[model samples]
Target: MARKSGKMRSFNVAVVGLSGTEKDKGQAGVGKSCLCNRFMAALADDYSIDHISVLSQTDFSGRVVNNDHFLYWGEVTKTSEDGIEFLFQVIEQTEFIDDATFQPFKGSKMEPYAKRCSATKITSAEKLMYICKNQLGIEREYEQKLLPDGKISIDGFLCVFDVSSVPSRTIEKQVEAVLTILNNLIKTKKPIVLVTTKNDDANETYVKEAEKLVGRKEYKGAIMLVETSAHENINVDVAFIVLAQLIDRSRGRARVLPFIEAARVR
Candidate 1:
């Protein structure tokens, strides 16, 4: 999708926890700082995605976007809400291309094939706009769904997992919950790419447990586990390439390498 043309300084993507090496000792899962760092590294190239600013939980001096939403990770506080909300705030502030110009694919490729389904045929991108607004709790208007540029509709969400740091028990439960969420969100048979970040910080035991979790899931075939690091500037590009593939797929362009390729592995 094209970017909106305007004099707006820049879009805001709050990499809440990904900008530093710090971690809350009490938290059990992957560190927010690490995740934010990796996420930013992966998405920085996209003109649509921007790192506006980070608001630390300890010190929140009103760095919220558009004076409404606060981008945050870790735990919810008065300063910020939740991880999902943090993402939505960024989306709300960003602008997309002309909302009226999108040409919905009309070919048979847009038809149901095998298990996958097609995009919405409704001329208006209302359904997606509603989900993005309400599901993420952006607190925007029911009518203000479309941005000035009109491309707020998201085809699907790509969840990047840091399996190596997730506790075994928590990992199992989170995986199940994620699968359920994805199954529901993609009810139209949309694709949800669940890619795993490469974690050298995790020990062998954690890796084994993550592999086991991957094995137990029905979506195992599409899961990709990468061992990369943003600090080292590791296979970060691969994630964006995968994201590009997803964008192409959304446009009815099928990719030959359906599986994780060797280049992205190392």
Candidate 2:
């Protein structure tokens, strides 16, 4: 359930990806961190595409090369024409471990590999819910009163793929990873958005191939497909806003304006 405070509604979205390793040559990293950083930076200041620093290929590949996860909070105070405001708290996770064996990844600058494989594991829907309730502090009041009440913890998911790496089998594996977690782990309907990152270097052939894959029956559950470029700030904000709107719609709430219109009005 959404935690509401006055006109603002808070949502927890999981930004999932398969971070590329050194083996994938010529393919920039999945760009999940870059996208999250760009969005959060926009939230903190004016939404300028050029203000944020760009991560070089070496830095992008080296940073977040492991299975570490991060949490980012952003608010879209821009009231829609319908007067709806949204607060989006996103968790950027590259792996999905089982709920029973989930442990938070603890890595530091001095010891980047400390407890890496042991701590960083994949997460299931149940595990994500557990993190939302216990770690992210989304619904403290509700949890205190109704501790065991059944409710979907995560509002939506942003399954990210590297558009530049779409030709590789890694894209298929990434898609399968998400489907495996969603279909086998916890059987609940949650909104999913297919996000292809690094669109600035997007290959038309690769992009078309990814679109074809998303059109398959297995990926029919994804409500939207956003092509984004975190380095160029292309559709970064729109991706989150669209997912937020879809989450609201999934819960049978009044629909908000499209991200373009809402952004313009703001």
Candidate 3:
């Protein structure tokens, strides 16, 4: 049995999102960039982040290269034991658009017709799933087999999706995929935090869909809904602090003494 009493256990979390301009001019949206920036800021006290690596097609190699944010330790090479081990740890702290895929540059481009690239129609969820399966050695079919390593099994997953960029044709399925992943993950009895990556009212539809999914089903794990935006620094701190508390509680670690209210600052 994994010892679930270590308040001192350090965690290496990866906040995967888009970077670079719509067509690779190296400009990212305020919402996507801020989501991660704020998350790091909030966790700076309890945990130390190495560097925020901007993950893209160019940096997916199995090399420990320095990056502006965290060290961009490219894709996990199957041939290298060290690479696999490092990626496995990252997978543990990862919070992405979808529980299954990562495509960091899909929506960053201003217009799809611009660069005239291969034009791969990849959704945020599919992109993230690709990273997990190809880079992290985690496949949906084999996740169960990969579990039982004596670790707390991801403690929980917090997926932040910027629904505004979702394409019209596949939006419904994209949303459904998230619900499915959440339902499956909750079975582990770990807390799942579904965060809206944008604060605009335009995203209310997406938030509502997520809420419906959680409320319609009786999940074994705790579910939380938060609206996060990095530019204005809206609920970034609130989301992270909330997750930290959830993580602490789930691991059966520290608990606030009686009558000491857990501060809920907006």
Candidate 4:
């Protein structure tokens, strides 16, 4: 699960959460920003879990596969000497034009995982190459929007909610965001994970309600429902990792592997 060497890559992770002042009902203090830390290579300010970058994936048939690394996306809301509040984005991978418009992004964690699940009929290296090519295409799609002339191409989204918020209010907003992303940014259905933070405030009722809501909507891609706590490091890694795995599967690849990094000398 080491970072691919040679160059530093980044990605755009849609970290959509409530941000507000004390005047607002569902304020921003929720661990929304903190979850961004865990998703980006285990970057907890008070605590840490490095495994967020790599997910132990599997195929539908069921098989343990290689660890896939994913990028966390967001803008820097808070900054400190130790690190920063938002997920890191590589410049070249972004559509940053000038100081006024600094674009941030997260890298695709697919090529590695795809390299591991290649069908028996296809060579691993070949599969990896295919994944790389697709990723490049996705990046290109966003490249236009990266320019000022185009709009942002948000392929996926992560709706973060706090357990302390009004259950109905938070869940409602989350569902709305998912449907909007489905109809707008993405060309096809994409994976969406429901992330409820603050494990200490675990509400069984809220969890059940959230599940029912998702069941009713029925997203085309895989769905992961989990409660995580950046405060206690509870299932933090699993949440993000599962999202990455599901996204890789969305590409219609029943299996995976690589030709770029896993190419054989033969």
Query: TM-scores for all candidates?
Result: 0.41, 0.55, 0.46, 0.44
- Tell how far residue 158 is off in model 4, in angstroms: 1.6
Residue-by-residue lDDT tens digits, candidate 2, 96-185: 222333332232321221112112222322222221212233334322221112222467777676667544446556555444443422
Candidate 2 local lDDT, residue 27:
31
lDDT per residue (tens digit) for residues 62-158 in model 4: 1111111122232222222223222232110101011222211122333221121111111111011111112332443331212112112333445
Off by over 4 Å in 1: 1-151, 165-169, 212-217, 249-266
Residue pairs in clash, model 2: 96-122, 96-123, 97-122, 97-123
What TM-score does model 4 achieve against the real structure? 0.44
- Identify the leading candidate in terms of lDDT: 2
- Worst 10-residue lDDT window for candidate 4 reads 90-99
* Sort by TM-score, top down from the best: 2, 3, 4, 1
Alpha-carbon shift of residue 254 in model 4 (angstroms):
15
Off by over 4 Å in 2: 1-7, 24-27, 43-68, 72-83, 95-152, 165-186, 250-266
Best-matching candidate per TM-score: 2
What overall lDDT, based on C-alpha atoms, would model 3 receive against the true structure?
0.37
Off by over 4 Å in 3: 1-7, 11-34, 41-58, 62-153, 163-170, 250-266
RMSD of each: 15.3, 10.8, 13.7, 18.0
Clashes of 4: 20
The lDDT values for all models are: 0.33, 0.49, 0.37, 0.36
